[model samples]
Target chain A: MTTLALPTTEEEIWRYSRIDELDLGAYSPQRCATQVVGDPAILVKSSGSNVLKHDDVFTQTNRDNSEAIVIRVPKSHAGGAVEIIHHFDTSGALYCPRVIIEAAENSEVSVVERFVSADGVKALVIPVLEVHAAQAARVSYLAVNELGATTWMIAHQEAEGERDSNLNLSVVALGGDYARVRTECRLIGQGASAQQVALYFADGTQMHDFRTTQEHVAPRTHSDLLFKGAVAGKSKSVYTGLIKIHPHARGSEAYQTNRNLTLSEGAWAESVPNLDIETNEVKCSHASTVGPIDDDQRFYLESRGIEPATAERLVVLGFFNEVLERLPNKVLATELYDRVVAKLAASETVGSE
Target chain B: MSVLEIRNLRASVAGKEILTGMNLTVRSGEVHAIMGPNGAGKSTFSAVLMGKRGYEVTSGSVELDGVDLLAMPTWQRAVAGLHLVMQYPTEVPGVHVDELIEQAWRTRGRSTTELADAVVAEAERINFDARLVQRAVNVDLSGGEKKRNETMQLALLKPKFAILDELDSGLDVDALRDCARRVEDATNEDSLGAIVVTHYARLLEDLKPDFVHILVKGRIVESGGPELADRLEADGYAAFSG
Candidate 1:
């Protein structure tokens, strides 16, 4: 086995990241395990990740140290939210967990993988998830990151949807010192559709970074990506995404939008959206916006008797309402809304002084 | 005792003077019609009273119930019982009308569920379709529908003072009458003091305003009873021009 060097911010994919701050020598690899809570038949040993290939140093390291967990959803299973809760507690530890989800043809399934950590513990978690949606299948997957304040997470999610399948992917990031998720999705079959929605907020000295790619490889595919975030108290967030339509992917439709809100003077956000369309019959568009909330929107609510502070809180939460509504589960969305409100309330007290 | 007073109001926008020493007083349970031609600063007067930014008040005083309104922030003014029914009601995506009005009552510590029911009942009063309550605030609504939604808020909040700026511009005959009836109903139910700005007397007919002031060049050039509206309707704003 060859020793892989740590990555730096000089690479295009790692630009503007906190890669330099990461010290690989500080952590030793640990074997991770998973326990199935739902149908035992769904849990099986897999040889490797077919969808998520090792593309970066972190992924390669994860592959080198992690034990694999495979979830197999049979045809017509009609599953609910199957949860895989992974908690890290060891300090000065490096833990890698690999997961693969295969939704059989004509099946409908939803999975939620939540990552957590012991409070104030310094640790690193590198997780990789691969999802393969078979023909005519429907899959919904959510990754919720609620790590400890001193912990860091470097994760990758790769998915492929086959002929006429439907894929719904979501991410809700609210905690961590430095967290990053690189999502890559490909529509490899005709008439397939994918919807990606994410809501990430960072407070204190935390940083959240996201990179995504929506690739349409077949004709008449559709994809919509919306990622919204808020940063306060010297925190930062970055969003970079691409919408690519191949030459043979005629009559395809793709849209990518990334919106960020900077709540404090020290808070910062960067948004970059790109499109590469080789077919004239394809429809692709991308938009990115990063700034403070609009004054007019706030004033409009205030004039209607909403207190300025409450009005701002409403706008920030409301900014995520569209994406929240698009979530596969409304109950989960409501819970997330309340969490965001709590974060805003805490920030309110910070600003009052 | 309850009145909205604007005295010697001189204001400007972007260094160009608009309101030149305007003056008016709206008492509770009274409706005032402000008739003016284009460039007469009717909208500017509404904006200034609402404490909208971009309008510099050179010399003026706005008082609500003897409290100096100009001294408070825009939202504090709302909390103090002032509201504006903007001509072009702003659209706030992702904010539902029912939810926003619920938040309105929430700030006042009112029961939001009760206020929500009140919104639906108020919608019925204006013949507004209840389905629209679920839609985002003012988004994709017709001009007249937007006016009706505004009236619903007015009824719900029951502000001590309200200003309707060009709410009758894009309404049809029925819509105009409906808007007028809604305003009249709110005044009867809550004694809502109101300032209605318009360029036509058609809306004033249904309103039967207690007072009519012809504002030209940012000043009240003419003030009279309901008959003033008829007179202006017969002789256009030509007599008040310049």
Candidate 2:
């Protein structure tokens, strides 16, 4: 069994990441249960065995070791939440799952992938996913991390949209010891649009890292990305994204925004956004902010009779409302908000030792 | 009993003295109009009363119905029935106006369903656009609408003692009249004690304040009836501060 070398933090693509700390030799590959909690018939269709091109260690390792599940949505099947929960119970082992979702032409679908583990289960999970949105199809996928504190995950997602297609990708990162996800989105057809939104919160020495790319390959394509995270309890978060417009992709519009809130003085977050435009006819902009929650908003809420602790929680939840409102699944958004509020209550006291 | 009483109040911010030995008293079912010139510490007094940070109450005793108010946190003060219609309402981007009021009343043990009803009913009674309650708290609201929203909140919460710190500053004639009527109705219903802080006499005239005080240099230099505000409308704070 040949193993790929682990990425080091010195690598620019993995800069400020915990990749160097991962010891691939410590664990061996194992297959986790990928149960379709919903009707499998609606999601178990195949779009043929389309190969994904990627050399990343986690992606290759998953492809070689894990079973691949290709979920197919029939043409014009507009309403299906294809919810899949990956359960990993093996301790001191490596679990990997690969999911491939193909939305047929003019079909709308929502694929929810959640990673879960029991408490005290120590493992490393690597998942690779590919999403193909066909012409005029609409697809929304959400990945939620609910791993235990003893686990870690490094995942990658590659998504491409066809002509006039729409794709929305969202993430809620609230668990695991150290989790990193790289999302790459390509608008492969003219009039295609894609939105990438994520909400991540790290506490109690946990870490979350994200790398995203928005590639506009066709003219008149548009992409918008918003990622928000909060860190507390000496935890850390890193976000680096790129919006790339090809030379012939004229009249393309891309906007990227990343905002982070540091609830404790010890907590830290870093945001870096880049734009690579080869044509002057493109409209592209990126904005990034990493700071503590505004005292004005806090005081305003406090003055309105909300307890300080409760006020902080509400503000933190409200901070993510902009992104949550974009979710196609309202029930998932509300449940995710409750989970975030619980995470915030743990670190509500900003200065308390 | 005094609904609110500030005894020998002295406060400061950033090492600068603002409220120096100020004293005031209010009882339920009474409206006290406080007229002060610019730099007279009107806003600071409101901040201090609300327990807003950075305003150090150097030496003072604030009692809300005999409860030691200074010891409570800002939110607790509101829960204890002390409300302020801020001059400049803070803009909370993602919090809707209805959510703001509903959350505040929630702290007072009000059920969400009850408070939601109150928010809608009170907004209607104040003639506030029901659509405004759907918007973010004070974000992109017109000045008049903001004041009306605060008045709408005042009606919903129905605090025991309310402070209108220049609530009339940004309102037009009709907005001023509308807000005044809402405040008046809330006071009559709750038997609320209120302190109207302003630089102009228009709001006081609309509300028909029972007692008017000319506050100069952080101290109440004179206290009388509606006639006092009428006189100050003509004389200005220069008559008392000088």
Candidate 3:
């Protein structure tokens, strides 16, 4: 096996990241079974991830020593929903869990992946998920990160859409000391489309980072992204996204937006949005904003006899409602909404001061 | 009976004084109309009374039932039975009208279940579009719909004093009459006092007022019965300007 060096903050892709603080020596790879709850016939032990590239040290490491599983939906079949839960309980351990979802031609499927850890456990979790949508297929994937306060997670999610295929990707991150997700979605066929949404809240020294790319490589492809987050206490967050339309991808449309709310004096947020269009007939737009709760919105609610804290909570919830409506599954959307409310209630005292 | 007394109310915006010793007293079940020209401190007065930020009360006292109103925050003032129907009601996205009203009603120690029924009943009484309650508050609504939304809140919340600030600015003849009639019904049924701020006598025709006051240079320059509004309507504020 070849020894590869870990990535540092000096790399352009790792800019504004806390990668330099990671210590590879403190962790050793451990094996754990990922619980898959769904149609048993759909699960198959796969050799490795075929949809993702091993261009980075993390991906290579995961490929080197991970038990890969694939959930395959038969052609023209509708796989209602599947649940995959990963639980970490060992301290000072490294976990590399790989999952690949395959939707055959004209098939439809939905999956919910959750990562959780036992309280007070300190570990590093590197999770990789790949989605392959064939022609005229539809796929929806949702990821929920609920690791322990001391745990660290670096997740990679990649998806490819074929002709007339549709993909919906969503994430709700509310845990881990430092959680980062890198998402790359490519529309490689004509008339393909992708929609991405994320909601994250960080408090009590937590940090959440997101990097995304929406690449349109075929004619008449479309992609839209919306990521909203809030930082309270002494926590922080970062969101950087890019919309890239290839030269041959004429008649493509893409939009990227990232909005953040700084809820406390000590909390902070950073947002950067970029667009690269090499084609003439393509339409693209990118927008980002980092600020505090809108005073007018707060006043509007408070003036109606709602208390200050309750008003703040309501405004924050309202801010996330747009994203919530687009979530693919109704049951999980309701659960995530309640989690947001609980998170706001937990940080109310920190925010008020 | 409830009383809203504004005594020697002095306020400023960005260090520039707008209200110079303004005084007014409103009692329950009474309607007072304040007519003024543009930039005569009409909106500033409402902002100061509602404790909206950025309006500094340099020296003044607003008393509600002999209790200091300036000391409480805006929500507490709402709980103390003070409401303002804004000239341009703000649009709150992703927050439904019924959701906001229900939560606001519950905050005042009222039953949540009853609020839903009351909202439906109030919307019907005012001829308000019942469908709007399910949509975001004032989002994508026309100017007349916004005014009707505010009037619906006024009738349901039932505050002791309701300040109708430019309530007729964007209303048509029919919409103006509907909103004004709702306010009149509130005053008669709930004994709600009101301070109507407008530039013309059109709204006064639908909602009759017991007194009419001409505001100039931040103070009441003339006060009389409803005849003052009719006379001012025939003529302009040339005689009232200092």
If the candidates were sorted by their lDDT against the true structure, best first, what order would they fall in? 3, 1, 2
Weakest lDDT window of 10 consecutive positions for candidate 2 chain B: B111-120
Candidate 1 backbone clash number: 0
Query: Candidate 3 residues B1-242, lDDT tens each?
Result: 89999999999999999999888999999999999999999999988888899999999899999999999999999999999899989888778899888888888888887877888898888888888999888889999999999999988888999999999988888889999999998899999999999988889999999999999988899999999998898888998897
Q: Estimate each model's TM-score.
A: 0.95, 0.90, 0.96
Model 2: colliding residue pairs? none
Q: Which prediction has the highest DockQ against the true structure?
A: 3
Across residues A149-257, which tens digit of lDDT does each residue of candidate 2 receive? 7799999898999999999998889998889999999998999999999999998888999999999999999999999998998899999999999987899999999
lDDT (C-alpha) at residue B34 in model 2: 88
- Tell me the tens digit of each residue's lDDT in model 1 across A258-327: 9999999999999988888898998888888999988878878989988888788878878878778888
Query: Which one wins by lDDT: 1 or 3?
Result: 3
The C-alpha lDDT values of all candidates are: 0.86, 0.86, 0.89
Candidate 2: TM-score?
0.90
Query: Which sequence of candidate numbers ranks them by DockQ, best first?
Result: 3, 1, 2
Which run of 10 residues does model 2 chain A get worst, by summed lDDT? A45-54
Better of 1 and 2 by TM-score: 1
In angstroms, the error of model 3 at A325 is 2.3
Cα error, residue B6 of model 3, in Å, equals 1.0
> B1-242, model 1: which lDDT tens digit per residue?
38888999999999999999888999988999999999999999988888888989999899987899988878888879999988888887678888888888877778765766787788998878888989878889998898888888888888988999997877878888988888887788788888999988888878879999999998999899999988888889998776
